[model samples]
Target: MNIGATVVFSVLFLLVTVLGFVAAGWRRGNLDELAEWGLGGRQFGTIVTWFLLGGDLFTAFTVVAIPALAFGAGAVGMFAIPFCIITFPFIFIVFPRLWRVAKQRGYVTVADFVHARYRSKTLALAIAVTGILALMPYIALQLVGLEVAIGALGFDTSGLTGDMPLAVAFAILAAYTYKSGLRAPAMIAIVKDILIYVTVIAAAIIIPGQLGGFEHIFAAIPASKRLLRPPTASGLADYGAYVSIALGSAVATVLYPHAATALLSSKSGNTVRRNMVLLPIYTLLLGFITLLGYMAVAANVRGMPEFAKYFAAYGNNFAVPALFLHFFPSWLAGLAFAAIGIGALVPAAIMSIAAANLYTRNVHLAIVNPRMTALDETRVSKLVAVFVKIGAIAIIFGLPVSYATDLQLLGGIWIIQTLPTVVFGLFGRTFDPRALLIGLFSGLACGTWMVAQQHFKTSVYTLHFDGYAIPLYAAMWALLLNMIVAGALSVPAWMRGAASFTGLSGSGDSLRDEA
Candidate 1:
């Protein structure tokens, strides 16, 4: 290890670790309550909410994996930019309503909202189960990001021993998150986001100069690696997969429990609204990140004979780290590495908290003990957070890095099936709980099958109309069929007057007493 890099990384890691522990007391409240522990007492304001959501939504996956995809597959990887652009606007439209209902009903998880709306344990359980499954792989992607960063610093991450440092880092994260709950990530996000901004700005300026310039970087790339669309057999531009991936990801981004956790932690519906307006600035950082991939191509980081075999064994996930180490001095490179590592902690903590909340509310308390106290619920959530972290680490060891990335993608597909019940169900009263259940299961099955048929390589299917192939994302296709079947099934329920059932149609003040 370069001593300068190692020293800087060690100091930064220790500082964040201490901050995590201290966060438990930052906004002192009833720590034994689910609302306090799971949702930060639902009291974050505009800036805090902004940082929390920004840190939660933009993870090491955004910084590392998206660019790695760009590095490897060119334009298809840049799906993330449009994906993010579409997400905030969609969130703006749907989330404030979710915020109003959740605050009013004292709901701590998405399942809580579903249960309040439908009065069906079955429907709530389905959403709870899907959230947990989707979040685990997402948490694992954080580990993947951390591992890539550590490896970039010249650490040996080749086997189980190679993962010991990661194991220790996560253990510390679990400890603080269990102690501080959502507050740990909420506080750490500030530091992580600051480091991320500085690092990205520096890279955008410094890397282009090192590689001659933007034009030279583009010119240096091979034809196969430079196309904005999928290259045809004759090297033509076909953007079918690009458009599908972008739209599919946008629809799915906020469905993650952690993303919802951030929104719910806000002060009011207006806070969520203002955040939707301001969050797109984070997307600009991502443009720099995607550009780093092209710079990696220009620098020959992956193609260089000396480094080729190592990255080939590791997957192109190491592209950004390799580029930084090659071009920057040891100390600055260490800061970038630390940014990626600490960045993982923010989302990892929130995801575990969100997953734990689902289990405690929907599974444990709802199914196992309906009379469970707020303290009991908090206890269960804290313990489950540890197990969730363990599961994420297990995923890292159990799969190839490339395959782990695919699991994160599959998580999106699985979770997006809940949108009809969660997002659309907010506006109207047509969906019967039973119909929603059927639609969710149908979407899960069809979407999983489509993605699996492609051997998990892509999230799209080709539709032939008049001898022309129109590629559609599996999630969108599954959602269309889901809505069709659900609408058809719910018509009978609507005719039976099921739409008149009592649910969460309350106002902001409806929950003031509970608060």
Candidate 2:
């Protein structure tokens, strides 16, 4: 192990661990209430919300996988830059209304809003279950990033002994999140974002300088690797896949329960809108981070004897870590690794809390115990948060990282199925609740089948029509099928003039009030 690097990493990790616990008292709220514990009393201002959402969305997965994708798949991996860019407009236009409704209704999760809008407990359950399932693999991906960071520090990460550090790290994460609730991740996110910005800025300046500038870095890459493949007469597979992933991902990004948790925690709808405008700064940071993959390719880190084993073991996931280790001193590398590690923790905490909130509000309370008190609900959520972390750790230990990636792909597909009921519902559209439920089922089943047909190797599926082949995101295809089914069935209900389907509480007035 590099002793100096390990010391720096340890110190930084220790500092955040302390900060996590201290955050319970930061805003001074009653921890026994679900609103206080789950949503930070809906009290976060624009800056805190910015940091929280930034840290929550731009996770360790972003640090490890974006560059890795660029390193392996070339220009196609740069889709994430556009993906981030596309998502914020959706946030700006759609989510502030959601925040207003959630704030007024005391809805803690997307399912809570779904329940009120549709007035169907079953539909709410479907949304809740989908959120939990989608988040499990996402939480596990954080560990994948953390594992790479820890291994980069020169620690063994193979067997039971190698897994102890991950366990210990998550144990601390679970404890603080259970104690401090959303505040833990919200407070730690400030530090996590600073570290990430520092690391990215330093890498931007230092790596290119060492590599003889961006011109030479691009020169080192083959033309095929530097640019996306053009569309051919037979198909637009590459172009379609790029556009579909970007659009599908943009829609799916805000739908994640954790994303909603961050949005609802903000003090006002304007806070969400303001943060949406400022969040693009991270997109610029992402562009810099994505270049690290090309930097790794230029430096030939995989060919280095010291890093060859890591490449063999972790595949492209090690590219960012390997790049840091090669060019920087042990101390600086440690700082970068800590940034990645803490990046994992912030998201992991938020994801667990979000999942827990869903289970407590939508599942446990709605189905299992309608009479559960607020204090009891808060206790259940806290306990569920710990169990959620434990379950995520189990995923990291029991399965291969590829499994987590595959599930996360499906997670996006699964979560986007709720868009009609959640996002469209915000517009005061009155769809038959049963039809919406069927649509949700259709999308989930169709999306899963398409992904399975690809053998879980990719999220894009190709359609062969006449002689031309068209490729698109499975989620988008499934969503189309869902809307078709729901829209068709909803026509009957609309024609009947059923007042029950009109809006929240069977009246369009509540929705129009916000309008």
Candidate 3:
């Protein structure tokens, strides 16, 4: 066991645990009110919101999985850099409007806005279900990241004994989150971001130097893995896959419940907009993080006997951890690992809370108990948050890490289907909720089938159009079908003079006007 690393990791982890609990008092609000507990009273300023959104979006999974993808698949993993860059402009434009409507209407989840806008409880329920379902694998991926960090410190992450450390860590996380709610993650995010920036910046400077240089790192990669494949007369399959993944992911990034939760916690629309401009700094960090994969390739860590078992066991997910362990001293390695593990807690906590908000507001309050009080809603959300984390833990134990990654891709596919309803619904009231619901289900079914055709192994599916073939993200294809169906159905309603059904004229100002 690496005693020095373990000790440092434990110490840093304990510090965060203490901070998580104390955060209940940091913002100082009534813990029993749903707004106070779930949305941090919508009071986070530019700096706090910046860290919260960063911690929420750039997760531990990104640290592990992106680099792992780079290590194994070459330049395709770099799709995340462009994906992130594309996301901020969307955020700068859309979320400020969303925040305005949600704030005015007291909407807690996207489902809440969908319900209020369309006045369809069933449609809102569908949105809630999709958000929760999409988040399950996402939260599980965070645990996978934490497990990798813990394993790097020489823990016996096998059988029952392996599950114990994860269980204990989550138990502490759940306790603090239940007591503090959004404030917990909002406060802890500051520290998590600091550690992540330090770790990434240090690695960017130190690792390449140790492994000869950037030139050597690039030279060491096999020719096949050096760049994306060029398009041919047969099709632009590779280019399509690359561009579609970037575009699809950018659209899907802020649609997750966790992302919504973080954005809604901001003090105002301006805060969300300011962060959008500043958040791309993280994209730069992601670029460095992706390079770790190439660094691992340059160092040939997978070929080393010491890391062979880790590669066999965790696959590419261990690339960053193994890279740190091989190059850095034990204390520094421990600090980096702690950054990853703590990174997991921040997002996992926020995601669980987000899912709970969806369930409590859109599902339980709307269906189970219409008369439920704010206190009752807060209580139920806190309890649901705990259960959500438990469900995520079950996923980690129940499925292999690769399955978790694949399921997260499927999550993106599933969540993006909500775009027409949530994002488009914000601009104007043209959609019939029934039509949107149908489009949502259609997209879900189509995307699932497409991914299933690949045996759940890849998210990109190729289409044959006569003699030409094009591969693209299944999510994008599904989203296209969703928009077409929703638009087609709406046109019929508009022609029939069923203005109410079409949401054509009077329902309240569009969210854009409110913004």
Taking every candidate in turn, the Cα RMSD to the unseen true structure, in Å, is 4.8, 3.3, 3.4
On a 0 to 1 TM-score scale, where does candidate 2 land against the true structure?
A: 0.96
Quote the lDDT for 56 in model 2.
96
lDDT of each: 0.87, 0.93, 0.91
Evaluated at residue 472, the lDDT of candidate 1 is 75
lDDT of 1 by residue, 1-515 (tens): 66777788889999999999999899898889989998999999999999998899899878888888888888777778898999999999988999998888788888988888888999999999999999999999899889878877777888778989999999999999988989989989998999899889999989999889999998987787676655455422357767877887887778889999989999999999999899999988888889888999899897677566558666778789888888888999989888999999999999999999999999999789999977898999999999999999898888777677688768988998999889877887669889899999999999889888989887877766665666778888888888998999989877666333333236455445434
Q: What local lDDT does model 2 show for residue 274?
A: 98
Per-residue lDDT over 51-106 for candidate 3, one digit per residue giving the tens place of the 0 to 100 score: 99999999998899899999999989899999998999999999999999989989
Residues forming the 10-long window of minimal summed lDDT in candidate 1: 498-507
Report the error of model 2 at residue 339, Å. 0.5
Off by over 4 Å in 1: 229-237, 498-515
Candidate 1's displacement at residue 124, Å, is 0.7
> What's the ranking of the predictions by TM-score, best on top?
2, 3, 1
TM-score of 1: 0.93
